[model samples]
Target: MNMNVAERQGDCHSQLLSSHNARDLLNSVDAFLFDCDGVIWKGDTLIDGVSQTLDMLRSKGKKLVFVTNNSTKSRRQYAKKFQSLGISVSEDEIFCSSFAAAMFLKVNNFPREKKVYVIGEEGILEELQLAGFTGLGGPEDGKKTVQLKPNCLFEHDKTVGAVVVGLDQYINYYKLQYGTLCIRENLGCLFIATNQDAVGHMTDLQEWPGAGCMVAAICGSTQKEPIVVGKPSTFLMDFLQQKFQISCSKMCMVGDRLDTDVLFGKNAGCKTLLVFSGVTSHSTLHDPSNSIEPDYCTNKLSDILELLGP
Candidate 1:
């Protein structure tokens, strides 16, 4: 029988792996999409029992994909991090917003002769290069300052075709000015945002300003919205579906954030699991004003094994 909206909410509210049919739920999904920063590791630290749980899942023949909205690291860099943490993740198994941004440009047939103006770090630049695109302005322009004197002339590259914005630790007036000119003045210059997450775990201690801050700066100056290529956009989901040839119904998304991770899975028509080891708390999930809900809730990812194992 079909349950009403209230009943459904009630059911989901009580659907923690500890009390639910976890073994059946785990058996139903062929693949799992994981959000990295909070769900897998906080900063450089790995979550407890994560390695054992992942090994158990692999033993059961389940595929795993690490889908992260962090644009600060390329797939190769992510793989290295995984290795350093003793997690057996491959480069192809990782999907980051940096790679998504580059893939968006490539699949859209961006002009090869033109350059991409970067507002982020080496991650975006590396992905752009790997995608056969030249990237300009990043750490190289971090120390550059603008002269506010009267009649000061600022010369920006005319060959710039698109301005890609991500999480830039060294965000400054010069880079923003350059990006604004390209988008506002350059004909047909595309503005692309890796992700618009409001906050991120830049460190394990606290949340910091995310890529949205940088994207918003360019958006305000250009008076234009960017093509978001990360989670909640379904771009990465589409890419993953094609690359993995997996059906959305047979996949489960596990993450820590409701706005991005859970919402992304819901948008992509997959089962969603919310965990509390990251940015969100249990009270935040049950707040009266909160609308987004996942199919399941757990204290941590390792609960899949601890709660379900015999």
Candidate 2:
């Protein structure tokens, strides 16, 4: 799954544009949604010229929003990171997986008396709180342990109506045991995940187990799949559309990954752009097994600047 761009060489869609034709592609959309990490930054470092490219897009009167599947940070925290990188993004312009999970529950009319049992981190908890939902069972008691056996009942929280999973650095038998119990024992306990990305991007150029790894453990234990709220799911797009009243025809999704970012754009009826500065490689795009394709492909996000007329 981790093919290098050079190794995965193949023809992309016919929509591929050069510097000359790039301007026309840019003219086709009024709004732009970007993925963080691979697309904008690599860990704590911002991608070269990313700030200028975003500024250029904003100056062109294009609406911009940062969409990330990483549930480790809240919108406020994400905004702080943008500011730290000299990119002026407001919290309102950010939509992360944590927010999407919270919104999904809210729209479903999740019970006010019921609380969500979280297996993630503070970001998820904060987002749930911001959406007026109660979350428990995260780092507050991550160290708490309980021995559970097969088909054995343990005293559990009766108010837990949902089991939401994302990335948890402290994920242990305790969290997994409780999460499985909530899904197996509790009636109508909704299962949700931020993303299914197996390998997360890191600055060290090493692959780390993503949120999907944790979600997989729970799935294996409970024999249930979670409703993912991140990329490739139109839930976030639907939320953005309803909240911003923006038309998909005027929107474009730009990112480095294909399965999530490109598929997400395709699902939401937005133009998709794939940049090689991240996880996806040209060969991976060419892989016949890969069904997702972007409207355009470039070496890096900065390549799109060529579309910006002088």
Candidate 3:
């Protein structure tokens, strides 16, 4: 018997995975959607037993798709990171929010003549270029300072059709001004956000402000909410579904973020497994105020291997 979302959440909210159920879950899913930062690694350091667990899953013929909300890197950059961590992953197996932002524009038939104004990093620019769109005002405007004079005219590119915001390490007033001008001044200009994660593991030592901060700056100036293309939106999920010819029921989303990762899985009708190796904590998961819950909870991704035995 199949259960509704509410019923399923109520029945197995944060249910710890054991050998019996681990084997059952393993056999039930044909694909796994993983959030990179928390589930597979934290910052630059790969999680212990991750490569082995991924190998085990691959050995079972489960399709692996690394879906990340981090927009700081392109698919190629992510592939390099995977290689550095000693995990074999192809660029095709990675789906990042930066790539999703570019895909959203392409799939929507955005005019090729108009360019995109970026308020993020090179990742956004790279993806936009790969999608055959020109991107302006990323790190190029990082050192630019706008001097406000009495009659000074603040001019921006009129050909910009969209403003894409992501995790920008070099965020500055100049980029924000350019992006805001494009969104607010340009007619019918689209405001697109990669993700709205509040915080992320920017470095191995600690968390840092995420793309939401950059998006919020633009939102504050333009007074327009952006169309999010990342997790919890199902935009990427739809793309993945069509590309892989897989149903949501046959995939499991593994991550450490409840708001983005787990909620994304639930929204997409996929099974969710939350690991406590990143942003989320045990108390936070069980908090009464927390409505979103994963179908299963484990200490880490490798716990599946331990639970399943040899």
Candidate 4:
């Protein structure tokens, strides 16, 4: 019964002609954009065939780029991790949301040389500092502007260039309230967030809150929509095109999530390929009418190689 149901539901890929067609089309693809975390590897372990398939794609002369929302590490660190995984990737090939955020602020004229109050994690804070945004109320000056607690608000610093939000494992009420106030006081205060992945890596579905969660809370309090520059934001795409001279027409975003990965490609005017090896598993690939569909779907990256046509 399960076999029959699975076949009936997912036979789109099983169809011999459709499978051949997708492979042929994918072979013609030039630039391949990948999403990390769920798409390439779930948590720490490498997803099977990932390394080999990427190598294969590279051998086929297709340009590769790994675009991720995970800002916990820099591009250099991510490249090292991929190298450690036997997947050869250069630092220039990786694009993280944190990097994009910093670049976005820099490009958008985010008030250079300002002491900014941050309500995010180390990754974000590091990028802000690199971009010249100083930390306010941090322990450096032995200052304590706001106490950590639920529904707490920190005193505002006049020099906040923007209220940037990312994955905060140690978030509290004070951070949320103060961050929102920064946006509310001036709707033009420049709001930014990482990504909107609600749940991640766990059983019993103990989904952790995403940056979008904080953005939502702040938006609820401030009536301001964040300048989302993550997946589907086109900021990264813009960065890529400007850096590499790759046309948007020849780019393809190959990821595993429908909401983020696929939507990113669709919004950025790139082809979207949904691989079942990551976040949105086979079961979640149902209800086609539910919105957020990819241009092509495959069970594995290796399967994409065959699409290169005979």
* Tens-digit lDDT string for candidate 3 (119-238): 988888999999999999888888889888798788999999999999999998888889988998899999999999999999888999999999998999999999999998899998
lDDT of 1 by residue, 1-310 (tens): 8656555445345367663567877889999999998899988889898998899999989999999999999999999999999988999999999999999999999999999999999999999999999999988899999999999999999999999999999999999999999999999999999999988889888899999999999999999999999887899988888889999999999999998999999998999999898999977787655788888888898989897765
Against the reference, the lDDT scores of all candidates come to 0.91, 0.86, 0.92, 0.70
* Candidate 4: tens digits of C-alpha lDDT, residues 243-303: 7887776888888778888889988888777887666766666653436767777776767
Best by lDDT: 3
**Model 1: lDDT to the true structure:** 0.91
Off by over 4 Å in 4: 1-19, 135-154, 202-207, 305-310
Model 2: colliding residue pairs: 5-281, 8-282, 8-283, 9-283
Q: Superposing all C-alpha atoms, what RMSD in Å does each candidate have to the true structure?
A: 3.2, 3.6, 4.0, 4.9
Residue 51 in candidate 3 has what lDDT? 94
| Clashes per candidate, residues 3 or more apart or on different chains | 0, 4, 0, 5
Evaluation by lDDT, superior candidate among 1 and 3: 3
lDDT of 4 at 142: 25
Model 3 weakest 10-residue run by lDDT: 3-12
By lDDT rank, best first, the candidates go 3, 1, 2, 4
